[model samples]
Target: MARYLLKRLALMVPTLLGILLLSFAVIQFVPGGPVEQLVYQLKGRGSGGEAAGGGSSGALYQGNKGLDPERLAQIRKDYGFDQPAPQRFWLMLKRYARFDLGESYYHHQSVTSLIVSKLPVSISLGVWTFLLTYLVAVPLGVAKAVRHGSRFDAVSTLILMLGYAIPGFVLGVVLLVLFGGGSFWQLFPLRGLTSDGWAQLSMLGKVTDYLWHLVLPVTAMVAGSFATVTVLTKNSMLEEIRKQYVLTARAKGLSETRIRYRHIFRNALIPLLTGFPEAFIGAFFTGSLLIETLFSLDGLGLLSYESVIRRDYPVVLGALFLFSIIGLVTKLLSDLCYALADPRLRFEGAPA
Candidate 1:
């Protein structure tokens, strides 16, 4: 197992390199990059008033035209564009090796600092989504399985299917329209994780306000997520109930509840466990963009999107690096979960 783990970890180096290299290449090739933006800055005609370097607006120029060739060359050299792409990539790799993600071009802040500031919102959303999903899904699925073809199962299936069909952002908009201050019921806050007066609120008030703002966003996030787990649980339980082992347990005069909970439950959990790593990491990393934007939450997902739009390469690349590492590690953790849930399972080439 240790050898297998080491081998997998070793494989991540090349995988990570490939992902970063491809991303870097794309950024380099894309137009309207840092150099062009800087030319606009120096010309002082772009939408953004001034560039990061605070270059003076000397003349109105378009697309580097009418700009001094020397100044243009100097801008390229200063931004390290003078070097070949390979050399720049290598230098970036070295900095990343030291865990130095560098500074954001637009934000004028270190990449790590920006991520740190934004992480709490994502973590909050992710945790709530994860907990709500599993806590509700697993039990709901088991109930549906046990009572298959009953009114309860039919109703829940219909509800879950409707939720699955609706996109999260769309649900968010609907939620806001119905519950936000502007509309029908006005049951929830429209944006942000807390009220402006959060710091001044009492302990209980703070908690209430936090959860109050979380309602729409969390609901939107988990709206479509429940079906997969719930359905998986129901189907797995149904399949387990029919297995010979379950029948054997019943023959031994075990109660129905004991048979279901003890023997069938453990086996049914294996397939569900396969989804754990993905759901876990996804809660933290993926699918935050539209939700965050719609609800006005500042999270890593929103930050990443902003970085791309503004061509903030440092933050963009840094976020990708961080997310990739987390994803690879989570996959390994999922394999561990599989081994734990079913000892019969083993990493390939490991001793039986």
Candidate 2:
């Protein structure tokens, strides 16, 4: 297992390098990059003022317009705009190697610092949603499978299918309208992850304050996601239950509970292991982009969204790079879980 894991880890370097190279190539080749915007700044022309770095940059550009060609060359060289793609990419990789992700073009903050600052809120919301999803889905699925073809199963199927049909963002909008300061219940805060003056609150008060804020967004997130897991769980459990071992256990006078849980659910859990990484990843630390935007939660997803809109390339690249690393690591972790769950997935020397 250790040797197999080390091999995979070694392979990740080139894989991640490929991903980064592709991303950098696309961003670099795309029109209207940071350097081109600086051109607008230099010309003192407002080709959309925001892209030109606004009034101060325009003034700075105007001041430098009368400078000698040598100064202009120096400026371009300083920013690496004069370099070819290969050199630029190599430089970027070198910077990343030293953990210097560069400063945000617009925010003027270190990219690492910016991402770190926003990561916690997304993680907090994600973890709560993850826990909620598994807590609700797994049990409901088991019950549904156990009572297959009964009224309870029928009702759950209908509800979950309905949820599956409705996209998460659409459901979020509906929920916001019905319960978020609309003509309906007006039961929850319209946006944000905390109330005013929450920082000044006592510990328990702070907990309640955050939970109160969490209710609606968490509701939207869970309601949108839990249905799929419930279905997966139910199907896996049902398949395991119908296997010959389950029948043999029942014939051997094992209680229904023992056969269902010990034999069936245990095996059923193996298939579901594949989903754990995706489930946790999509909710626990880095998903719910639309939902976060709707609620005005300051998270990495929303930051990436705004950065893209504003053409804040450093922030965009930094956020993407961070998520890319996390995704690859999580995929590796999922493979590890697969081997742990099913002995058939051996890492030792084999026929393969």
Candidate 3:
């Protein structure tokens, strides 16, 4: 296990380098970058302020002309755009090596600071969604597997299918329209992680208010996610129930429940357990964009989206690098989870 971990960690270096290189190369060719955005903003202000203050056609045209060459050059230089792309890439790598994520071009805040500020919201949303997803999915899946072909199973399968069919964002919108401050009912807050004056609430009040605000967002996140795990669990258990060991246990006069729970469930868990790491990590990062936007939650997902639209390169690349590292680590953890779930299983180099 130690050797395997060391080998995987060593391989991550080149993998990360390749990912960074590809991303940086793409960013280099992308239009409407920081320099262009700055120039556009300047020209827009010139056109708006001057024309609104009664400037003539020639003046408006001149305002539209854009920045002087020296000013443009300076802007480019300040953004390090004047350097050759390769040099800039190398410099960026060096900075990252030293753990310096640098400052945001537009916000003027360090990329690390921006991520730190936003981490809580993402963590809150993610943790709740993760806990709720597995907590509900695993039991529900076990029940479905045990009662397959029954009325309860058929009905639940229908409900799960419907939920799986509807996208989380769409469900969020529907939920908001139904339960939010919309005309239907105002059972939930419109948008936010907490109500105003949340700090003033008592301990129980704070917990209530937090869960109150959490319901819609977490519900939305968990909506479609249930199907994958639930179905996998159901199918895995069903497969296990039909295997030779289950038949032998049943022939030995074991109670149906014992055979199902002790034998089938334990064996089925290997497939289910292996997915926990990825799902847990993913719950924190992936599939959060629209839900955050709908709920007005300022999470990492929203930050990444805004950075991309605004061409905030530092934040984008910094987040990309961090997320890539997380992804690689998650993959390793997943492998570990697999081995932990089934002791009989062995990797290529693992001791027999």
- Kindly list the per-residue Cα lDDT of model 1 for residues 1-352, writing each as its tens digit: 8888999999999999999999998886555667767677667666433332232232223546888889888877977789999998999999999989988888888899989999889989999999999999999999999999999999999999999999999999999988886568889988889999999999999999999999999999998989988999999999999889987898899998888888898899999897798788888777579999999999988888878766678898998998899999989888899899988887875565
lDDT of each: 0.86, 0.78, 0.85
Better of 1 and 3 by TM-score: 1
Backbone clashes in model 2, listed as residue pairs: 126-284
Instruction: Choose the strongest candidate by lDDT.
Output: 1
The alpha-carbon lDDT assigned to residue 11 of candidate 2 equals 87
Best by TM-score: 1
lDDT of 3: 0.85
Q: Model 1 Cα displacement at 177 (Å)?
A: 0.6
Error of 1 at 65 (Å): 1.9
Model 2: weakest 10-residue lDDT segment is: 48-57
TM-score of each: 0.93, 0.88, 0.92
lDDT of 2 by residue, 79-195 (tens): 677888799888888888787888887678899999888877788789888999899999999999989999999998899888878877888888888988776778888888788
Model 2, residue 226: distance off in Å is 1.2
Residue-level lDDT of model 3, residues 42-136, one tens digit each, is 77653222233332333424444745888877887999989999999999999999889889987899999999999888989989988988889
Instruction: State residue 230's C-alpha deviation in candidate 1, in Å.
Output: 0.7
